[model samples]
Target: MIITDTHTHLYSEAFEADRDEMIQRAIDAGISRFFIPAIDSTYSERMLQLKRDFPEHMFLMTGLHPTHVKDDFKDELLHVQTLLKEHKYYAIGEIGIDLYWDQSTLAIQQEAFRQQIQLAKQCNLPIVIHCRDAFDEVFEILEEEKGDDLFGIFHCFTGDFEQAQQAISYNMKLGIGGVVTFKNGKIDQFLNKIDLKHIVLETDSPYLAPVPYRGKRNESFYIMEVLEKLSGLYQLSEKEIAKITTENSKAIFGI
Candidate 1:
């Protein structure tokens, strides 16, 4: 039962004290694939070191996150461009408009998102999106850029049925995470209606921990809680869910 965490900040400082142990715990629990998203140039070295440590399990992406977009965003995009030229990344992502943090940066955020989407198209790589309080904004850009070359995962998707379908129309697989296990996390209500092929599992670890572990720091191993919840919601066995979602991840990441 190999599971894939399509979007996780495994290089995050949250696991600094026991990163190896936490990762090993997830591996032992059969969550072997960890796709690491880039936030900014600052974390690039840490991300590289993580890949070196777990060369087989860690997949890397390069992009400037929406929240990190600022006055110096041009330099940051340059850094992303330079990294793309120097390294082999699986995708261009964790990039999109994040109005929740600072709505003032919406203009720059949309520009950065458009530029990175173009970069993804140029590289023929999938994109992992990080959207928050900007579904219409994100979808607008996706609409403008939709085509064969634009395809990826909508990381940590939290939207209604219509939005989910719209995201699917843009070749995005819905990244289901710990939120699916939350009693009030509405995605679970209509998830069963969406085919398993359109879904992938994630933890967004050290962040949105599943219930039972909710309100606490999350680890990849805790993804099992998410898998269990999905199993019930989809009426499939846990192993089947893992297999299908992992395969869905492979379809997106091309691993």
Candidate 2:
């Protein structure tokens, strides 16, 4: 069985100590493919190092994360552009709005999101969205920018059925992660109704670990927890869940 963690920050400082072991554990658990999302220029080294260490299993994306947008965002975008020109990337991501943290930068954040979307198109790659309490804002940009040329995953999707439909309309797959296991996660209630083909599994690791391991640092192997929940939701076997989600991920990352 093969499982794809379509979204994760294995390069995050949270995994600085035992990143190698965590990755091995995931590989041992049948969680092999990992799509790495870039946060900013600061993490480029760690992200690249992760790919070097796991060349066969890792794919990389370049972009400035929404939360990283600040007064010097123009400079950051230039840095992102430089990386895009210099390296091969599967997507432009972990980029979107995050109003949950602060609303003051909504203007700059929106601009950055739109600019990144344009960059993704220019790069001829998909995008991975990171939205938090900014669906309307995110949707507005998606509506304005989406096209047959643009497609990707809505990473860590935590919205309702309607939002899911909207994301699908924009050629975006819903990335299912640790939230499905939460008692109040809410996604579980409506997720079964969505087509499994439109869903992909992820841990968003070193964060958002599934139940039993909830509130703890997430690991890719724990993707099995997501698989178990999805199997029950789809009435499919774990292997089937693994195969289909992996294929779905391959479609997006083209790996």
Candidate 3:
């Protein structure tokens, strides 16, 4: 019944007051694997410290997030590249265009996304995409870059069935999270149509918490709530859903 949270900011300051206890709750619930995504250089030091503290449980990824892409994005990309070269990370990820925050940064966001995708290709690592309000633009770039070498997880995916198929076409595994538990989340209606193999579980904690905890600060332990929801959607037991999605995470992260 081992569960893997493929997308979580366990190092986030949101859990500063009780980080250890919060993580312990997940561990006790069988959510052992935590894949931490990099936002930028600002969180790099903290991310590394988390890895050091939980080496066996934590897998780190290095990349500049879309919303964090600003005027000095080039330098940030360089920092990501330097980290990739000097250290080992599971993926180049949580990177993509995020027009939800600021449409003005679209040009730079696209450039950063493309550059990071190229870097992922060079490193032979999968990417963890963070698309928001820019699916068309993101797909356009993915179209230009699609190939045997391009593969990754569409992190925190909440797209339609057709869009889900489209992401799968790009060799992406859809990352299902707390949103699936929401009454109006929508994706739950057709999620069973997509095979579990094409799906991975996540919480995106300190963000999109599941029902019972919706709108509240999310944590990894709440991933179990997500698992329970999937169990119903797929007509499988919680253990089975955990196993399938953990395997799916392994397939993407290569853990």
Candidate 4:
């Protein structure tokens, strides 16, 4: 019953007051693995600290998040490159186009995304994507970059069946999170149609908490809520869902 939260910001300020307790809650619930995504150079130190504190449970990723892309993005990318060279990361991620925040940075976002994709390939690591309101743009770049070398998870995937299939064609697993438990979070409607092998569980914690905890502070322990929902969707037991999704995480993160 070991659940893997493939994407969770346990290093986030939301848990600053009781980070250890919060993480312990998740471990107590069997949600042991937590993959931490880097937003920028700002959080790099804290991310390292988190890895030090939970070395056995936390896997780190290095990259500049799309929303954080700005005029100084080049310098930020350089920082990312330096970190990748200095430390081992599970992936180059939480990176992609995020038009929802501001459409103006679309050009820079696209460039950053492509550059990071190349970096991921160079490092021989999978990428964890953060796509929002720019699926077409993201897919176009993925189309151009698709190859045996390019593979990862479409984190917090909120697209349709066609998009899901498209993401898979690029060797990505769908990262299912708390959204699957929402009343209107449409992914659940067609999720079962997609095989369990292509799906992985996440909480995106301190963010999209599942039902019974929706709109509240999310934590890795709440990943069980997601697991329960997935169990129903796949008609498998909770333990089986955890096993399969954990295996999928291993395939993507190579851990």
List ranges where model 1 is wrong by over 4 Å: none
Backbone clashes (count) for model 2: 0
Instruction: Report the C-alpha lDDT of model 2 over 196-236, residue by residue, as the tens digit.
Output: 88999988987899999998989888888999999998899
- lDDT of candidate 1 over 1-255, digit per residue (tens): 899988889988999999999999999988899999999999999999999999999999999999999999999999999999998899998899998989999999999999999999999999999999999999999999999999999999899999999999999999999999888889999999999999998888889999998999988998899899999988899999999999999988889
TM-score of 4: 0.99
Tell me each candidate's RMSD, in Å, in order.
0.7, 0.8, 0.7, 0.6
User: Which scores better on lDDT, 1 or 2?
Assistant: 1
lDDT of 3 at 246: 89
Estimate TM-scores for all models.
Answer: 0.99, 0.98, 0.99, 0.99
Instruction: List lDDT for all candidates, in order.
Output: 0.94, 0.91, 0.94, 0.94
Q: Mark the regions of model 4 whose C-alpha exceeds 4 Å error after superposition.
A: none
- Model 3 Cα RMSD, Å? 0.7
* Higher-TM-score candidate of 1 and 2: 1
| Candidate 2 Cα misplacement greater than 4 A, ranges | none
Model 4, 1-255: lDDT tens digits are 888999999989999899999999889988889999989999999999999999999999999999999999999999999998898899999899999989999999999999999999999999999999999999999999999999999999999999999999999999999999989999999999999999998889899989999989999999889998998998999999999999999999999
